[model samples]
Target: MSDILFTRTDERLGEFAVRPVRPAEDTALLHGWLTHPKSAFWLMQEATPEQVEREFREIAAAPSRAAFIGLHRGRPAFLVERYDPAEDLAQVHRSEPGDVGMHFLVAPTDTPLHGFTRAVIGTVMELLFADPWVRRVVVEPDVRNRAVHVLNEAVGFRALRTVSLPGKDALLSTCTRAQFAAAAGHAPEGSAAERGANR
Candidate 1:
């Protein structure tokens, strides 16, 4: 698809592909995900399809933000939003150069895989780092979302401190490229050949 950004396959999770969100065509599907009871942290439990459409349309039109749909084995499985932290998070947090803000939601599924959510988040981080300019990934997850805090640590995010946002107190966190490489247990980009030599 023209919108596809990249495709990756995790040994245990099958193939996952990401593409830009289509506001018109994806409104109904995204509305369901955002309103799911399990998506309480998303803070849009009562959003209608129209509201979802308008929200995503605005995101799609914004120059500093982008939304993507992640597909697993050709089926839509998650939603991701990437934004320039300097634009939205500046008021709440001091954004450094190369900071990128992210948010993600795994679509509610009847058959939930044990580590599917982790894989989705890992994929999202990798996609962000694929850009040469991104040196750090920043996230401000709700303080009440302990599950996500655990997940964020698994991906190398170190929680800084609680910060009050518009409605929720969020745990500000950051992950650098080096930290992610260490946690993910992979050689940094451009070190693959060096690893072969060392071995």
Candidate 2:
């Protein structure tokens, strides 16, 4: 059975689920997504299937990282990765106790849905913040990827500054739990309990 981590519903997109990645089983599918022209910023355009399998295997074995496959209804639609900033991105930025780093990529479709990408990002943020200990989420996307910058803003990520990574200049950004709540239109975390008391 697929080890499902969580499930969420988007009003416009219906239901989607996230599950632990099965490296061996998911390699071909992931390879296709990462090599597509639209995935240029992912920096794996030339990776072979064997290479993809090896990479994911290492990720799965890492204690500070996790990879998830996003499923729309029942079909795979996207990928998500969560890592401990202290271990994964320490070279690029300072690590904090409650900080978690994230990366996601939506599968390319010939016909794209108007709000699909936004919904995907929102779901990813929601998943991260669902962990009570996660106070903030961090991302370092390629600076030249304008579409993602816009999406990041819409989801409440504030750009800090650009930093040169090994191969790409990345726009470092962060979103706090409260920021995500505001952007996602939910009341801030203690408000609901306060409201219940008032009632």
Per-candidate clashes come to 0, 0
Q: Give the Cα lDDT of each candidate.
A: 0.85, 0.84
Give the TM-score of each candidate. Answer: 0.92, 0.92
Q: How accurate is candidate 1 locally (lDDT)?
A: 0.85
For model 1, residues 1-199, the per-residue Cα lDDT tens digits are: 2556777778898888888888999998999999999998989998899999999998988888888898899999999998888888878778888899999999998999999999998888887777767899999999999999999999899999998887699999999999998888983332111110000
lDDT of predicted model 2 = 0.84
**lDDT, candidate 2, at 17:** 78
Q: Which stretches of candidate 1 lie over 4 Å from their true place?
A: 187-199
lDDT of 1 at 186: 86
How many angstroms is residue 181 displaced in model 1 relative to the true structure, after the best TM-score fit? 0.7
What range of 10 consecutive residues in model 2 has the weakest lDDT sum?
Answer: 190-199
